[model samples]
Target chain A: MRGAVRALIALGSATAVWLGLLHLLFMADLDDFFGGDSGLRPGAASLAARHVKMWSEPTLKELELKKMRQSNAEWDFMGRTFLVLALANMSLRDPGSADKYVDVIDRIIDETIKIEAEHGVYYFLMPYARERPFMAKSGRSIFVDGEIALMLAARRIVRESDEYATLLEQRLDSMVHQMKDSPVMCSESYPDECWMFCNAVGMAALRMSDVLDGTDHSEFISDWLASIKRNLVDSDTGMLISSFSVDGQAFDGPEGSSIWMVAHCLDLVDPEFARDQYCRARQELGRSVLGFGYAREWPRSWQSPADVDSGPIIPVLEMSAGSSGMAVLGAASFEDREFLLGLMTSLKFAGFPVRRDGELKFCASNQVGDAVLLYAMVQGPVWASVKRRWNEAHVSSVGWVDKSVPVAAAGEL
Target chain B: MRSDFFKLPRIDELLSPRGFLKRAAVLTVVFAVFHVAGLREMTSFLCGMAPMTGGAAKLSALMGLGYVVSYLGFIVIVPILVIASALLLVSSRIWPVKPRV
Candidate 1:
């Protein structure tokens, strides 16, 4: 018994020392894990860079195009979107070559929009999309519409295009119409299924509206918030549910995989709400051990199965691919550098090998998975600039005053 | 009467450090063969990959537990055994086995 006790104490002491050392190393600014200064850190950028360089030459582009021709045409399209977003964020950080990157981005946006218009949104959406019509009367998906709009908005921000501006406005109008029609002011992406992800995309669209047209949908945003508080938010946790029925019935509870990025998107619509959700998520979901940060797909009490969205769940650790990818956006948005760096390190050590030639592929992830990672890396500048502009416009009487003045003048005169 | 049946190999040969190292090397090679053959997929049991398909929940759970143990044995125990054998060989060489003094 005495020997056993001594052994237990020794083990505990060693574990404490090991963990403390790891924390100290992590806190010491050991390396630029996010690839901010180091270029691409192994996760998504490598894969994207491979695709871009591969497609840069005509022969490689033809080969890839031919290979993807029969498979999910959506992968080809989404790959372009992911690459463009990655480049846009990269451009902000490295301004000397911003224009060159922006040119590629513009081409991608033009191509994606053309494909969607020609083939229709159904072409890119999953097979279940055709099984039942969209709940929105006009049959537009917030998923397709919001991402495309954001893509256009991202391109226009770098370099304005008249065509993109027009396209963004039309999509925003459709989204607004759909929102106004729903009693809960939430539009569904699939047959009665309203996903928090799609709602986030909707929020992104609203943000782009403020950016492109200088419109303040604050009242509409407020009403929607009230509705979400009433119906969508989980009562105990105060986190947003992953999905809901058209009538605002909760389908899936708050998911770590979805809510982290959703919270980042919510920052655009409602900053206070976004912060609250993020803090709750961080408290409930984010975990660190031995200086490595990983997230569970669900809270301890909320049970969920592994799906395409959550990717594979690592047992014992309960680390999730989707949540880990989305956690980047959350950590970066909140400036949780310690957590972000830890997560990045863990990703490098565990996720598939990263090559120097910029051919990064996670052994455990698929195409869409990598794309989301790329999105997280390059996300900040666009959202930051838009949020900054909104702050300035709100503080000053610039755009809002001019519109309000005409109505007041008409009343007075 | 049992002398012939109980006879043992020479202590000089059996306890030689070089002989121990040769055995350790053989074990390592065997472990490497299993590792490179993609038996690591078995480790997916620890990661909650399905152990049994097309079965009732109770039976599947039992099979899953079995797979998890076997997989952990492959990944964790095998590595430990190989490492221990190597350490034993190296220590014997360094200490000269003390000649049972």
Candidate 2:
């Protein structure tokens, strides 16, 4: 009996060590999987191939999109938006195969514009978007305007298009008009509800427009940032609240989904402030356990139920697939390699990636999830252009829009 | 024991360090069989984005849950059990529990 008990104890100890060893082994390979620049990144290539393949096969696209649309039409639409932007960035980043990526980007942009036109704006919006009338006269959602503008602007950056160029300026004008009209310089994403994520994207598009065109909105962008600092920040967390009313009242406190990319977007608008937000968000939301890093939807201080944005929170750990996945953007944007690697490991171990014949899809994720991953992988070029422009010159009081320099090289932005 | 080929191992024999390790290895093999039998596809429900459009959706989700549980066992629990049991077996062989406390 004594011998048996002793053996059992020894077995338990060995189990603990064995588990640790397995984790260590898994972690050792994360650099290859998540590192920013490796010579040949098959993961990005495989995922991009899968996305491009979906677009070419309409039936496949419809079937997969139908599944997501059944839950949230916004996802169905956002999936297309993210993929377009990723393809544009991919085109710029991988100039060797730019033609194929550009083809797919054009296809997606055309299809998305058709869908919006045919189905009307509400087709891509959530059901709740119709519950209360939008304050804006045209029944616009900042969500739609922001993403569509970014998509258009991103398309123009890789290669110039006269048609899209005109359309991009119009979208920017409408968004700017709405923001200037609102008390907080925030536009509605869902009727009365305005999202920082949408606003950030909207601002990002505005910034990009200035880059592509010799037009400046730095003062307008600056006022909006000032208003956010004064009215939109969550008192407890000091992070900007995720959503607010059109008139500027808080909807909820900081959320991982909204804040991560918001921080990334802020890098274009305000570098110092964006870094501050990223640091706060990282501290409040990020968690690592047993060598896997994940994020919580809500901080322990502020409580909100899991909705589409939050996804389902795994109870004890407060691990959220939604937040953790978006956190990939935050980590990658800030070059937080350690955290990025940890999250990437969790993704491989749990995301249930299915790779075959050089195409990869995470069985555990939907179209939006995969597109978001693609965005993180190929994000630097356009942002680099915007940052270069911001750093070179301060906003002139007269709103200087320099037109003398050749713009194709990206440095002139 | 030598004469009766049909007799099962006694509790003591099964509980012996080597016996425990053998049992764990056998269990792991069983789990690997289940994993290969195509249970991994069903595990996508764990991501909460599983398709709900067709009648097959719910049935598929139920099957997926089964696959996820089995896969988790195969990847996590089974490995630990096998390694633990092996450790116990080795320790027992190297240092048979002393007679005194």
Candidate 3:
């Protein structure tokens, strides 16, 4: 009996020692993961440069191209957008090596334009696009037109390219005209379908137009702002609705998948409104625990089915791929360093294995997903430059326009 | 007769230390199966996002937690347990005592 007791004591002691050691090791690993001075570091360019070199090789390019072909064509288009935006941001951040990256970006922009012209806008859109005709004439989607125009504008801002300037102006004019014709100042990409994402893109295009042409559309911007504040924004949560009809009736409530990044884009045109939206979104949607951060697809009160926009909702936690990707933009824009780092840590550990060669391809995430991440990492400089110019002009032109009619037609007093 | 009786197999011999190691190995394999099958993704359901598809409804949250714990245990703890058990067995063997008749 005594021997048995001794044996039990010895076993218990050994178990305790092992567990204690394991706990120490686990804490150390976690500390290494979370302990960083800052979240927004300047290493994306180097990472992207490495990817560019890897992609420059014909064999690797062929392999990636083959995989993209098997998947959706939008992936192919989005890949170019991400790389171009990264390159543009890199050019501003680091001019010495900017030209090489700019050349690559220009090539992507040129190629993307060619593809859009050849295959038509339908090529990049989902199959549902064909299910119904667009409400607008010429069937141009604000989604495609706005993003493409932004890509071109970003390129031109980096280096004065006459070729892209013409394209940018044409696209901007079309978007502006579409916004003017709509009774509620909202353009539809589908039959009676308007999306917050597209609208944000349109706003971004307008902001870019203001940047490029020195023109002011403060009236038009303010009018839309008032409309959003009155009709589009959810009163309880202050988050913007994701979709609406042409007549400004809500189609979908505020969605986690869209609101966060839309808020980031909205920051360009209206910082106060954007910050308000972001703060509400963070309170309603963002979650953090045990030093990790994630977001839900919908608020607790609102229920919606899992669609392509949400992208494979994980049961129980309510994590959405789209929301998770967009959360990066929100966290970065708001300067929520802890949340950003936690999310980044989660991404590194969970969301598809990112290999060491800078070839970050998530298993569950498609090309557009990665592009959004790339955009989040490099979005600051472009918005910063635009804001700087706007601030400088504000002091000079105090009596420019009335605050009530923010949405004036381009060049209209 | 007394010596022959003493020659009988011991409990440690019957359940070899190496055999326990093998069981730990089996636990590790099972843990890996569930993890790669994306049972970890189900943990997201706890966050209130609906399941990706209908098939995920079958696994209860308790079952997922059990699988995750067991999986982590097998990968992390089992190896240490096996090593410690092996050391204990070897130590016992090195200091063997004679049974009184």
Candidate 4:
């Protein structure tokens, strides 16, 4: 009887201790893990260290890019764009280190441009992009034009460049013309397919360009917003659909992977609309259970098979790696501290963070994933700077006021 | 301790508190070996990166998965075993068992 009782005690104690620890860990505020003060987050700094090493060493970068390029060339392009965005924010957050960050940013921009020139736009796009001819007369991709413009605009936001300034103007003019020519008021990412994600990013680049060069895209931006609001939104969910055809027919419903980022980009274009979409996405897609937060690739009313953008979806949990990664941006952008904490908990639990020689990388995440996390960690300063400049420039002429930038609540993490 | 590590244990001893500690220690050492061997970097294959430049992608991915499995065991399972062993020892002392008839 005693032996049986002892065995029962052992099993019961084990269960209790295990459950208790997991509860404490998941429920505990992860602010320290995410770090305090915008750019100084220890996690962000470690990720930056790894990226800096990768950019500085050609052999290392070659290996990493080769792997990503093999799976999907789009990752190679996206990895560069996100890292540039992160470095730009980092530069703004820490001005003392701005020069070093700018040097790397220039190298990335120059190299990316060189590659695009040597290879065609299809080089960076997926293989299917070549399956059809571009609908635009210029035969240019807004995916390529928009991201390249954003990269240039992000760089100039930190510090002006005469060369990049001229380049940015050319790209912006070309993109604006293309959007106006399109029936849907948005240019195509793939032939006959317009992604709200890419269009929102293009608008953000336009907004930033207006702030930088004293040009006004407010009217154009408003028209684009109206076009999307009217045509691209899912009627059932009240959230923006992921993609549409040039004639404004919906191709995909509201997707967690696309909407989180689209919501983030929309903030720079239209704040009220951005918040509404974010709230809807939060209601329809975001989830928290046992204190660990994740996002689904599709809402309950809509579902699609997994794609390259959605990554792998966990069955019962319905958690998407790609959407959850981008959800960090949404949570950060809207100051959703509670959701941010939950997502960070899940990331820590499953991201398999390995720190070595003062640098850290999540073994479960690739270069683009880490870069996106880094951007989430240090996003505020650049957006705030852009909004401040835009408001300052437009206050008298456009009758705009400076709204407070979204600040992630300090202790809630 | 080093000399006895390789010796086979009887079933009774394997279930004892000392055996649990031994098992935990063995896991710790093995995880340490994998960590020191730089398998953590290889584990990037989890995100679909081909683990190494010149290596066979399959082999490198397998090694990375091996390290991840070992790491999960070390971090999640080892502590539970250790705590359960300590609890078992305390339970036995508090209510001593009579010898088998």
Candidate 5:
């Protein structure tokens, strides 16, 4: 009895202590992952400083790009795009530091556009993009067009550029024409395929364009929203499916990686519906255990195979690196402070953050991943600007201010 | 004949544990070595770092896996072990373990 009692004591004590103190290892706050009064958090500043340094220093930048290119050339380009975007948003938030960020942004934009012109669209795309030709008259990838447009739009949002205005409009016109031309109003990223991720991004670019140029694509956008309602959502999960054929067949189910940003982009298109999607996704994909929060790639009801985007789901927890990275967008988009805090803490715990000479990088994540984190920390103001523009446009319009209708806010899309 | 980490300890010894302290010290030293050796950078492959070229890719992956495991062990498991041990000591002092039969 004495021996048994001691054994129980040791076990019980250890359990209690671990249960109590294990969370301390991951203690962090939302402020560190978000903008405060100063418009830059410590982690965000370190990350931005590191990227700015990498861009200014060519050899280090090449080495980093080469590693990413070997995996996916898209990621290489995406790293540039995301960083440029983060810088643009940062510039808006931090006017004192705006000039430095704008310089880096312009350099990245010039280099990116030049590289695409030289190497062709295939340079940044995956091998499968070449497997079949695009369905449009011009062999353009929506993946390229959408992101580049957003980069341009974001830059112009910070400080309007005459050069970028033409560039943004040219890209948007072609995309709008192509999307409008399609029977289902979906533009292709891959051959005969349209992704919710890319479409949402394309939509965000459109919304941002309206913010900048006073152009209205409300009819086009609302129609696309109608199409989304009719065809894009998964019935089983009641969340939007990820990809579809140009003719509007569901290609993939609601995915965490896709939905978080989808919900975020929808904030520009429709705030109430965006809120609805976010709440539903929070119900399905979001997980909070003990104190740490994570997101799973698929809802329990959606039977799907793991794909590249899921990024090696942890065995039983079903956490996806891809989804979790994008979940930052969701949490930030909705101002889910508690979830954001928990997720950032989990990131600090798992992301293998290294700080040297005031530079921060997550060792367990690559350039694109780090860029996404930076964007998460500083995403609000850009979207806020878009919404403000949207509200301004609709303030005098009849019946537009009515919040009673879900579709009335952004005009149903 | 054998070393057993999980072996039960007498209540009096647990109150001011030496073995537990020794284990914590070892973990700290090992973590220090890992930190100094720059194993943390190698762990970048855990996310998705690709090796530069042909034959080196496999080798780089192996090194990444090794670094990541050790890094996790050092940061997570070792701390857990040390804390649990400390808790055992604290519990011993609180209850003043009665002599085992």
Candidate 6:
């Protein structure tokens, strides 16, 4: 009996010690591990290296994209958008690799546009997209139009591209026309579904376009923001509703999957509102325990069934892998280093990261997930460029139009 | 016949502290094998994507689940078991039990 008691005590003490050690390790300051804006981060560089290789190698790109498309066709399109944005930021952050990153960005834009041209708008959309006609007579998707335009605008911001300049304006004009036709100044991502995520992205794209070509969309952007504040704010959480109808009736409540990216995009249009939304979201959906952080797909006040966008939610913990991944963007965009550090710790602990030949990829995350993380790591420069150009424009003229360097004379990447 | 307590534990002594060490060692070896075999990449299935472009997704996911389980055991359990075994051994030495007369 005494021997058994001793053994039991040993087991108990061992467990306590192990838990204590884990706590100490996890609690250690991990700022350097996640990387900051000081220089090129190893993880980001490795991730970028893998993406550059993928864009350059069609066979490899198709293989990876095929896996994601098999699950969600939208991921195929989203992966391209996130990668393009990441590369653009990388170009701006590290000019030595600008040409290479610019080359990949242009390729992604060209291929995406070519595919849309050949396969039509429904190609990248989900099957439900074709089940009904769009509310707008134009029958276009803001999801596609906005993201593609954002990609183009991002590339041009990094390095002037006359080809992308023409393409960006055409896409923007068509998208704005569709949005203007709606009562709420919103466009559809699905048949009648006006997603806050896509509209906010559209607004950011428009803002970037104005910065680039000196076009004025301030009134339209402000009107859309007013409409959203008036109609789309969720009563319980004060977050912008995730989905709405053509007339701006809420279809879904505030969702982590949508709100994080929405907040990030809205920062370009309205920083104060964006920050408020982010703060609310951080309170409602974000969680941290034992030095790890994650985001729930929905707040307690707004429970949602796990969808493709939310990915799988771990029960009890209420952790949504999809939302937690995008939360990285929100945290990074807002410069919430404490929360970002905690999230990165959880990512390193659970994300199953693999490094091969100086290229990094997370085994628990697909291409789109990794791309989102990559974009978060290198996000600041593109948005800063837009802000800088807007400031320059304001200082020069009384309007939202800036007298910027011409495309040919715009400094090479 | 009297058996030495410190001798290699017999199969009947599987419940002893040394058994815990043996179990942990086995788990550590298994996790190492899985890691070296490149099964970590298969864990991409956790987020709902096929681990390979053309292979059977279910099979890939099963392999991924195997790696994950072993990995959890390795990271969380192996150390505890080893430490427990070590502590038990130390306690036994400090407070030796007299054999029954």
Q: lDDT tens string, model 3, A1-413? A: 33344344445655666654543332212232222222323344334644476456767655554444443455566567666766777677667878777878877787778878999888777667789888888688877787788788778767877778888889988887887778778787666778887788778768766767777878888888787787787766778888988788888889987898788878877777888888888888887644456787888767887775676676888877678778877887767776677676556534533345534444334445655666667666666666655655653474432122243521243
**If both were scored by TM-score, which would come out higher, candidate 2 or candidate 3?**
2
TM-score of structure candidate 2: 0.89
Give per-candidate clash totals.
0, 1, 23, 1, 0, 0
Per-residue lDDT, model 3, residue A3, is 34
The CA lDDT at A282 in model 5 is: 90
**Candidate 6 residue-wise lDDT at A280:** 97
Off by over 4 Å in 1: A1-48, A54-80, A398-413, B1-101
lDDT of 2 by residue, B1-101 (tens): 57765678776666565666666676677667766776565555655666456787887777767666666666776676666667766777887777665
Candidate closest to the true structure, highest TM-score = 6
Between 1 and 6, whose TM-score is larger?
6
Ranked candidates (TM-score, high to low): 6, 2, 5, 4, 3, 1
DockQ by candidate, in order: 0.07, 0.43, 0.09, 0.38, 0.36, 0.50
Write one digit per residue (lDDT tens) for candidate 4, span A1-413: 55655655675788677755763554534454354445467667888999989999999899889877876788899898889999998998888889999999999999999999999899899999989888887888888889999999999999999999999999989999999998879998889888888888899999999999989988898889888888888989999999888888888899988898888888887888899999999999999876688999899888788778887787888888889999998998888999998888878777777788979888878899899888888887777878878866776677655444333321111
lDDT winner between candidates 3 and 6? 6
Writing each residue's lDDT as its tens digit, candidate 5 over A239-285 gives 88888888888778899978998898887887778888999999899
Window of ten residues with lowest summed lDDT in model 1 chain A: A398-407
- Give each model a TM-score: 0.73, 0.89, 0.73, 0.87, 0.89, 0.90
Q: After superposition, how far is residue A132 of candidate 6 from its true place, in Å?
A: 1.3
Report the Cα lDDT for residue A358, model 5: 90
lDDT of 6 by residue, A1-413 (tens): 66667777887888888865653454524443345543567778888789889888889998899899889899999999999999888888788889988888888899999999999999999999988999888889999999999999999999898988999999999998998888888999999999999999999999999999999898899899998999899999999999999998888899998999999998888878999999999999999877788899898998778889888788999999999999999998888887888788778777888788999889999999999999998888888789767766663454433223343323222
Q: Any residue pairs clashing in model 4, and if so which? A: A31-A413
The DockQ of predicted model 2 stands at: 0.43
- Residue runs of model 6 more than 4 Å from their true location after superposition: A1-9, A23-39, A395-413, B1-16, B91-101
Candidate 5 segments exceeding 4 Å error: A1-9, A398-413, B1-26, B51-54, B86-101
RMSDs, each prediction? 8.9, 4.5, 9.1, 4.7, 4.2, 5.2
lDDT of 1 at B41: 28
lDDT of 5 by residue, B1-101 (tens): 56865788666444334655565577667777766877667665655565344567667767667666666666655655566666666766787756657
Give the fraction of native contacts in model 1: 0.00
lDDT string, candidate 1, A1-413, tens digits: 33233333433544455445544433423233354532444444556576567546768655544333333354465556556767776667667768777877876777778878898888766677789877777998877777787777777666678877888888878887887888778887777877887777777767766866788787887788888878888887889998888788988888987898788878887777888899988887898877778888888768878865675787888888778877877887777887787776656544433366547654333344456666666567767667666655664553332121244542332
For residue A283, what is the lDDT in candidate 1? 80
Q: lDDT for each of the candidates? A: 0.65, 0.80, 0.66, 0.83, 0.80, 0.86
